[model samples]
Target: MSSPETFDIVVAQLGDNWTLTPVVFENEDYQLPDTPAPFVSVEIYGDFFDQASIGAGERDDNLWREGGEIFLHVMTPNGTGSRQARQYAKQLVNLFRGQDIDGVRFLDASIGAGDPGRSFSNYYAMTATIGFERDE
Candidate 1:
């Protein structure tokens, strides 16, 4: 029903493969843990909706089709190459590809290296985009 709920569903789908918890909401302030390597986070970045039909009334009731884009951010240990980060991103993609969560169908996923300007030195950062939709 909400972004946090959707993020929890996604994390559950990731299962035992992922252990670290990163920030889930965009623009939410967060502090990173001082632990070791392999930090990960999931967030709902965007959403879209379409009205398919309108009911006949003074105030029309609308049937809506909704969808959203989920982003998974992964950071491996320092000195790890982008390959490792990409591998982790691939795993995240595989987990959600063609799967449905609470009636939300995951359509596809794309992975890529994180922005160099935003990433830290020696840290392998990658991001994955998951496309999902649902009829309501």
Candidate 2:
């Protein structure tokens, strides 16, 4: 598999930490459960940057700085308080706060305070965006 595909799988595995909600990964033909339940949506974004050169004659083309964020959207019932969702976010934080998975060194995680606007009448949602980087 290519690097992006490998990264995608690595990020998807982090969603496994959320056992309370079903996970929906990107690139899959999927829809949230119809019964108004909690669920997780996962997407991966990455890029490679050129490394600064310090030598007069060296192969700099091979040096690359790669990184990305694992964007996870956790959805829960709107009427219910966000305690469960926040707890889930905490679980995610614990999973990736400062760890490396498949060469992706996770730097930190950001949990959305709360987003009622992202919710419909029946479900409220929050986001946990985990940032990671690697140099190769």
Candidate 3:
């Protein structure tokens, strides 16, 4: 069998706020440096998806199994980089939340390029995936 994927799982119960478990996922790309902008993308990603907590299940080969994906792009003034591309990707996931018929998880976040000189233009993109358990 393939190796299992370990992720930083966050769970939101029936009424309480979401909780971030201490268990660290095998993937550490999601952890970002403490930036001045504070990488508000995290907040945006979560709020955009209305996700209260992280997923609570294993991932399949599909894009998402239970959790969703959020993309964040930091663009330059010239608008020439992977920043916008990445943001667009996250937007794609946000556009289609709670609509999956298969009930799979899709927490795949990717980043693009950044403008080396621009202020915030130092573009960067981020995606957050949320996976949930399959119901009987």
Clashing pairs in 1: none
Q: Predicted candidate 3: what Cα RMSD to the true structure? A: 14.2
Q: Which candidate, 1 or 3, would have the higher lDDT against the true structure? A: 1
Q: Name the better of 1 and 3 by TM-score.
A: 1
TM-score of 2: 0.77
Segments of candidate 2 deviating more than 4 angstroms: 1-12, 15-18, 52-61, 113-117
Ranked candidates (TM-score, high to low): 2, 1, 3
Each candidate structure's TM-score, on Cα atoms with residue i matched to residue i, is 0.70, 0.77, 0.24
The list of candidate 3 runs beyond 4 A from truth reads: 1-83, 105-125
Give lDDT tens digits, candidate 1, residues 20-100: 434344566666556546656667743556776777463336666667887777777666566777777787788788988
lDDT per residue (tens digit) for residues 5-120 in model 2: 54665656665555677777777776656678887777677755557454546576455666677777778887878888778877876787787676768887888834442676
Can you rank all candidates by lDDT, best first? 2, 1, 3
lDDT score for candidate 3 against the true structure: 0.32
The clash count for each model shown is: 0, 0, 16
Off by over 4 Å in 1: 1-5, 15-36, 55-61, 113-118
lDDT of 3 by residue, 1-136 (tens): 1112211222121013212111122232554434322232322222112323445464332232222233332322234554554454454345334433244334333333232323443433344333333222
Which scores higher on lDDT, 1 or 2?
2
Error of 3 at 114 (Å): 18
